[model samples]
Target: MPPVGRRERNKQEKLDRITAAAQELFAERGVDEVTTQEIADKADIGAGTLFLYAKSKGELLLLVQNSGYAEALVEGRSAAERIPDVLDAVLAIVRPVVECNRKQVDNGRTYLREIVFGDPAEPHHRDALALTVQTEEAIADVLRRDERFSADDAAALAHIVSAIMFLSMAATINRTNPINDVVQEIRDQVRALLRG
Candidate 1:
């Protein structure tokens, strides 16, 4: 890889500051409560510069979430690798993402809503969708390692499982119910699907 230029490093540093400030504030105050101005102030950048990084609050939330979700997927896959059962393995894969949602439930709700249905023409939305596809691939990898399905079957099943997980998680958000209940329900549904 070519060495990063000073300008690129500075830009990344600024972006990191923005993402960290946004993540901390969103976790503490919820997304709807935090303003882009506040995030810019916290990050020590001009509000206009913040706009350069994320066009809207929704995009800011996506920026904050993208790396965390990526890390969670990696962790989930590693955790799943330790589990023996395919069903449990798949659940393990999704557990980190669920936990990520719980970290900033309000923002997570908005993020999920936008990323799932937002226009692919938007860069942030496209990046989020790409991340989701990577997650599906990760899940497929787990299934392949388990020897529970052919490569093609695992790829197909990964999409089904991802959809199920997202829908289940979406239904559970802000419902005044335990998150685990929804997760358990998803596990049951997935088990049924795998049995067929």
Candidate 2:
């Protein structure tokens, strides 16, 4: 592989350090009590430098969420797009979530609680919604690439997929409601929809 360009490498390093420090702090202190100054101190950078990488607490949390989603998206795209068959498409997605959830078996509850119950009033909420739309659009691209689903169907399915993902994340950590059984039922329902 080609060596990373110096600028890109430096930027990534900064982001990595900031995110690592923030994660530790978040895990230790929770989001409300953890401030940018503290993360900067832990990261060995000025407080202003922290905001350069992360605008607010919400962006910091979103950054962490996206870090997980990035790997999941790549694996999902690779596994799903590998086949012309739609069942393969579903596998690409289901397999990644199951795999990620398995890998995150320990961290899932902590991360999920922080993400779901994290501060929605933070400045980055609107931006997060925009990013969510873009993500759905990207997922839509995969469904659209298949000739099986029309634009309308693809859009509807994309919404369904996004809804399932959101609900899965929500239910995964619910105290009264573990999602393992529900996910299976939901998967069966979606499979029927996809088949129809």
Candidate 3:
């Protein structure tokens, strides 16, 4: 690979700072309470510079949450691989993601709102969407482990499972529920899906 130029390195450094600052502030206070100026000040960059990286607080939230979601998906995929039963493997893939999303409930819920309502042209939003696709792919891989499901069936079922997981997380009622309860709710829905 070619060596990175100074300009590229500098840009990446700025983005890293921005992401770290947003992550800390959002965790400390929900996204609604954190101001863009605060994030720029914490990142040690001018407000305009921060805008160049992320157009809005929603984008910053997307950037910050995307990394955590990716890590959780990876953890879930690894856990799913060890479980032999189809439903168990699927929930293994789900539990970590639910935990990650529930870490800061409002922030996680806001991230989901952004995924649904934010502009698709935005880079951070696109990254979040890609992560969802990756998640479905991970679940499909687990479903495929069962002999009854063909590749197409696994993929289709995985998509439904993804919707169930996301909806459960984003639901207003689940907002106050413990992460375990939310995850169990998803497990019940998924178990029924598998049985039918």
Model 2: clashing residue pairs?
Answer: none
Question: Residue 45 error for model 1, in Å?
Answer: 1.7
Shift in Å, residue 109, candidate 1: 1.2
Q: Comparing candidate 1 with candidate 2, which one achieves the higher lDDT?
A: 1
TM-score for all predictions?
0.89, 0.64, 0.97
For candidate 1, write residues 55-155 as lDDT tens digits.
88888888888888889888998998899888898899888888877676667778899897676776777789988999899888877875668999999
* 1-196 per-residue lDDT for model 2 (tens digits): 8989999998889888888987787767666778888888988888888888777766776666555655776777777767676655755665555444434343444444444565655544444454446556656776787788898888888788766765654564533444465456556766776777
The pairs that clash in candidate 3 are none
Instruction: Please write out the lDDT profile of model 3 over residues 17-68, one tens digit for every residue.
Output: 9999999999999999999999999999999999999999999999999999
Q: Mark the regions of model 2 whose C-alpha exceeds 4 Å error after superposition.
A: 1-13, 27-35, 83-85, 94-148, 172-185
* Cα lDDT listed for each candidate: 0.85, 0.65, 0.95
The TM-score between candidate 1 and the true structure equals: 0.89
> Which candidate order results from sorting by lDDT in descending order?
3, 1, 2
- What is the Cα-based lDDT of residue 190 in candidate 3? 97
In model 3, which regions exceed 4 Å deviation? none
Give the backbone clash total of model 3. Answer: 0
- Per-residue error (Å), model 3, residue 101: 0.5
